[model samples]
Target chain A: MASATELRRTPLTALHEDAGARLVDFAGFAMPVQYEGILEEVGRVRTVGGLFDLCHMGRVRILGERREEAAQFLVHPNISKLKFGAIRYSFFCREDGTTMDDVLVYRDTDEVFFCINAGNRDRDIAWMREVVARYDCELQDLSDDLAMIALQGRASVDALAPLCTGEPPEPVRREGATGPAALKYYSFMRGSVCGHEAMISRTGYTGEDGYELYFAADKAPEIWNALLETGKSAGLTPIGLAARDTLRLEAGMALYGHELDDTTNPVEAGLLPKMVKHTHDFSGRAALEAAIAAGPQRRLVGFTTAGKRVPRQGYTLHLPGDDGGAAIGTVCSGSPSPTLDTIIGTGYVRSELAEAGRTLAMDIRGKRQDVTLVEMPFFKRDY
Target chain B: MSNPTDLKYTASHEWARLEGDIATLGITAHAAESLSDLVYIDLPAVGDSITAGEAFGEIESVKAVSDLKSPVTGEVTQVNSGLEDNLSVINSEPFGGGWMIKVKVSGDLPADLLDAAAYDELAAADAH
Candidate 1:
C-alpha cells in the first residue's frame, strides 16, 4: 500500500480527513471510501440526503464550430440535436466493438464538456485527440481546473434550491422560482451557488431527485462546507464511495470497470437501448451493427438471494440448486441493500436467462445459493 | 474503553483473556473500529480446534473481508450466536457483548502476545 503522499489528493482532501473519513487509494487518488459508516451513510441518502465529492472524475472541453459533430461521432449517443445547456450519457467505444469509457457530454455555451471516468481519463482524452483529426475541433483537458459535488436524495432540492442564483429552467423551478417546483430532472443552470460560481445540474447516479454542482477546484472547501451547513436542516450528510457504489448498483447504472469493459459491448451491458440505433460510420458502428444482427449472446440482469448471502464479482452463476454445475454468468456488482434488507446483485448471463422470473444460482466460494432474476433497479425511493 | 489493559492482544487484533484452561476470545476495539460497519462474521463452530496464529474465522464489513486469527491454540467451547442478526455490535462493544468464541486451551499462549500498551503502539503507528 502506498503512503498518502504517493497518491493524488483532491482539493477537498483536508476536509475529508478532518471529518474522520476512511480514505483509500482509488483510481490513483486518495479518496474517502466511507465516512461515518456505509450503512448509516446509505440510509441517510435514501431517506434524507447526502453530499458526495466527485473530483476524481475527469473533466475536459472540446471547442470548435464542428465540436458537436466531432463529439457525436466519438460516443454512442447521437448528440447532433442535443440542445445547448443539455447533457447526454454516452460511451466512447473502441473500433473493435469494445468499450473505451462511458462519458457525459455537457453541451456548454462555447464548448462541449466531456465528463470521463478517472480510470479512463487519459485514454479517453488521447482517443478523442486521435479521432479529432477527422473533424475540425480542439480538445483541452480541464480536470485540474474543476471540482464536482453531488447533492442527493428526496430533500436535496429543498436545501439547495435557495442557493442557486438563476431561475432553474421551467418545470424544475425551485422554491424561489415559484414553489413546489424542483430543477426539472437532468436540466442545469449556470449561476452562483453558495457564493461560488457553479453549474448546477439535476443529475445523479443514486437514482434520487438531486443535483450535481461543478465549480473551481480551489474553491472546493468553501462550497463543500457551505452545502453541509446549509443542508443541516435537510439532513444532508457526507457520503463516501461505499454507499455511492451501492446506490449506483441499486439504480442499475453501469460502472466503467465492472458492468462494461474493454471486452464488452454496450448491447450486452443493457445500453444499446439508449444508443443511437441508426447506422452511421461512428467508430465501432459496423461491428456493433454486426453484433446486433448476430444477436447478443449475453445480457445484463439483476438478481437477489435469500438471507445475508451477497453475490460477489467473479462468482460463477449456475442453474438453481447445488447440483447445477455449468456456469451461466458472472456477478458484476453486488451489495446487501440497507433500505431493502436483501442481498442484491447484477450480472451478465446468456440472453435466454434474462427474463425477470427465472431462478439462477451463484456459487458463493464453494456453496451454491439460489438467486432469482428480478427487474432492474433493486431499489426505488418513495419520494 | 478501546483496549482493556487486562486482555492480551495478537498482531491480527484478536484479544484473549485466559482463566486457567479456558480463554475467552474477541477482537480488540482497535480492530473493530478499523473494520467499521461489520456486515457479517463467519465464526468457528463449537468443538472446532484452533491453532495459534492461524485463522479461525472471517469477518466482513462493507469495504473488506478479513481473517480473524486465533491467539492461542484451543478447542472452541462456545460461539456468539448473536452476531447472526446484529453484527454491528462488534463495532459498538468489541470488548464486551461482541465476544466471539470461548475456547478450552490445549497449549500455552503465543510468546508475542501484546499487552494493551504494546497494541496501542501498533495502532498508533497505523494512524499515521
Candidate 2:
C-alpha cells in the first residue's frame, strides 16, 4: 500500500478539503470517502440531489474512420448498432470470457468514447492500443485532460438544465428539444456548461435521474462550485465515495473488482443476456458462447439479511442448517441500505440455490446469520 | 472534546470507569467519531470472561468493522443490549449511555492504562 504522500490527488482535491471531506486512499488516488457522513450523503442522493467528482475515472477516445470497427471488435457490444449520441454498457473481456473491465461506450459523430474504471485504466488502455493496432484507429488517453462530474437524484434536471446554454443539433437531439431536458436516457449532447465546452450525458451509476458532464480539468472547481451554489435550495450536497458504494450496491450495479473480475464471466454475472450482442464476432465471443452453452455454475444473487449484521465481502455463505459446513458461495459486496433500512448484499452462489425466496446462512465471525435471496435491483425510482 | 478526567483509557481507545472491583467499559468520543455512523455493535453476554488488551466485542460502521478491546481482565456482569438496535447513542453520547458492559474484575487493572491527560496526548498524536 502506498503512503498518503505517495497517493495522487485529483483536480478537485482542494475543493473536497475545503468542504471538510474525509479523504482516503482509493485506487492510488486521494479521494473523498465522505463529507458529512455516509448515511446522510446516501439520503441526499435518494431524496433531492447530490454532486460527485468523477475525475479519477478514466476516459479514452478512439478516433479515425475505423473507430467504430475497432471498438466493435474490442468490446462485447456491437458498436456499429449504437446510434449517434447514444451510450451502451459493454465489457472488455479476456480470451476465456472473463471480464477485464466493464465500460460504457459512447458513440459520437467523429469519435467513440470509452468510460472505464480508474484502477483498470492503464491495463485497459494498453489492451486497446494492442487490439486497435490492426485497424487505422488511434487511442487517446483523455483522463488527465478532462474532468467528469455527475449530478444525480430527483432535482438533477432542474439543477443542471438552467446552467446549460444553446441547443443540441439534429441526430444528437432527442424529442427535437434543446439542453438537458431534450436528452433521453443513455444519450449525450455537446454543449457549454457554465461557459465551458462539455459533453453532458444522461447517464449515472446511481439508480436515479442524473447527468454526467465531461469537460476541461482546469475548470473543475468553477463548475463544481457553480452547480452547488445553483442547487443549494434544492438540498444538493457534495457526496463522496463511501455513499457512492452503498448507493450503487442498493441499485444492484456490478462493481468491477467485486462482482466482475478476471475469474468471473459475464454469463455468471448476468450481463450476457442483455448487454452482449452475439451476432458480431468480438474478442472472447467463442469462449463466451461455450460458457453460455455449458451454463453458469455459480451465479450472482442479491440477498437481504435477517439481522443488522452486514454480510461483508469475502464472507462465506453456507446452507440454511449448515453453519460450519463447506462453503456454498462467497459475498461480493454488502451494506446496510439507508433507503430500505435493512442489510443487503450481493454474492455468487450455486446456480441450483440462487432462486428468490430461498433461505441461506452467512457465517459472520463464526456465527450464522440468515439471508434470503431476492430479485434485484433492491430500489428503483418511480420516474 | 476533552477526555473525561475521571476515567482511565486504553491505547486501543476503550475507556473504563473503575469503581472498586467493578468497571464500566465503552469507547471514547474520539473513537466513536472516527468510526462514524455506527450501525451495529456485538457485545459479550453476561458471565463471559474477557482479557485485557483482547477484543471483547465488535462495532461496525457503514463501511468498516472494528474490534472493541477490554481495558480490564474480568467477567461481564452486565451487558447493554439496547445498543444493538440503537447504536446512534454510541456516536452522540459515547461516554454516557454508550457504556457497553460492566465487568467484575478478576485481577489487577492493566498498569499500562493511561490517565485523561495522557490519553488526550495519544489521541491528539493519532489525529495527524
Candidate 3:
C-alpha cells in the first residue's frame, strides 16, 4: 500500500474533501470510498442516480492509418466490424490465453480509444507500445490530460441530456431525436458539456442507463459541480468507490484483480464465446480455441448464502460433506447487496459443480456455510 | 459524541461499566463510527471466559472486519442475542443499547484503562 503522501490526487479531490467523504488509497490514488454510507449510496443509485469520479482510470488513444489493424491484433473483439462511435467491452490477452487487462474499446472517426484499468495503466501502455511498434499506429496516453465521470441510473438520461449543448456526433444521431436521447447504449458522441468540449458515451459499470463524460482535466471541478446542481431535482448525488463496488457486484460485472488476473484466462472468467471474435487471427486465438475445445476446467459462478455474512475474496469453497477435506473453488468478489437485500458472491468452482442448483460450502472464518449457486446478475433493471 | 466519564475505556476502543462484581461491556462510539454501517456481529456465549486485551467477539462492516477486544478478565454472564439481527444499534447507540455482554469479573481490572478525557485525546489523534 502507498503512504498517504505518496498517493495521487484527482482534480476533484477538493470537492470530495469538502463533502466529508471518507477517502482511501485505491490503485495508488487518493479516492473517496464513501460520502454518507455504502448502503444508502447504493440505494440512491438504484432509485435515482449517482455520479462517479473515474479520472484515475487509464485512457489511451491509438492513432494513425493502421489503428484498426493494431486494435484488431491486440484485443479479443474484431475491431473491423465495430461501427463508428460504438464502444465494445473487450480484453487484452497474452499468447497463453491468460488475460492482461479488460478494456473498453471505443471506435471513433479517426482513432480508437481504449479505457484500461487504473492499476494496469503503465503496464498496458508499455504493452500497447510494444505491440503497435511494427504497425503504423502510435500510442498516446491521455490519462492525465482527460477527466472522466459517470452518471448512472434509470434517471441518467434525464439528468445528462440538458447539459449536452452542441449537436450529437454525426454517426450515432437519429433523425427525429437530439442530444443524449438520440444516442444508444454502447454509442458515443463528441459534443459540448457546459461550454466545454466533451465526449459523451452511453455506457457504465453499474448496469444502468447512463453516460460517461470525458473532458479536459482542468474543467473537472466545473463540470462535476454543474452536473450535481443541474441534476439535483432528479436526486443525483456523488457516489464513492464503495457503493460502486457493491453495485457492480450486484450487476455481476467482473472486476480486475478479483475476477481477472495475469494467470486467469478469459474462458474460465466466462467471457469467451460472446466477448471474443474468432473470425480473424488475434493474440491468444489458438490457445483460446484449444481451451474451448477442451472445455474450461473451472467456471465462474454466482452464489447466495442463507445468512448475512459476506463471502469475501479468497475464501475457500468445498463440497457439502467435504468441508475440511479438500477445496474445490475460491471466491472472487462478494458483498451485501443492498438492491436485493441479501449476501451475494461470485467464485470459481470446478466445471461440474458450476450449475445453478448446486450447493457449495464456503469456509467462512473457520466455519462451513452453505452457499447456493444462482444465476448471475443478482439484480437486473426492468428496462 | 462524548465518551461517558463514569465508564472506563481501553486503547482498543472497548468500554466497561462496573457495578459490584459485574461489568457491562460495549464498544465506544468512536469505534462504531470508524467501522461504519456494521452488518454483523459475533459475540461470545454466556458462561464463556474472556481475558483482558484479548478478542472475545468479532464485528463486521461492509468493507472491513475487526475484533472486539475485552477490557477485563471475566466470565460472560449474558450475551446480547438481539444484536445479530439488529446490528445498526451499534452505530446508533454504541454506549447504550449496543452493550455486548455482562461479565462477572474474576480478577482485578487492567491497570492501563484510560478515563474519558484521555480516551477523547487518543480518539482525536486517531481521527487525524
i-RMS for every candidate (Å) is: 1.9, 1.8, 1.7
- Alpha-carbon local distance difference test for all models: 0.83, 0.90, 0.89
Candidates, ranked, lDDT: 2, 3, 1
All candidates: TM-score of chain A: 0.94, 0.97, 0.97
Which residue pairs collide in model 3, if any?
none
Off by over 4 Å in 2: A1-3, A274-279, B111-128
* Candidate 3 residue lDDT tens string, A128-179: 9987876878999999999999999987877777777655566667678778
TM value for model 1: 0.93
Docking class of 3: medium
DockQ value for model 3: 0.59
Cα lDDT for residue A43, candidate 1: 89
Q: Which model, 1 or 2, shows the larger lDDT?
A: 2
**Candidate ranking (DockQ, best to worst):** 3, 2, 1
Instruction: Spell out the clash pairs found in candidate 2.
Output: none
CA displacement after TM-score superposition, residue B118 of candidate 3 (Å): 5.0
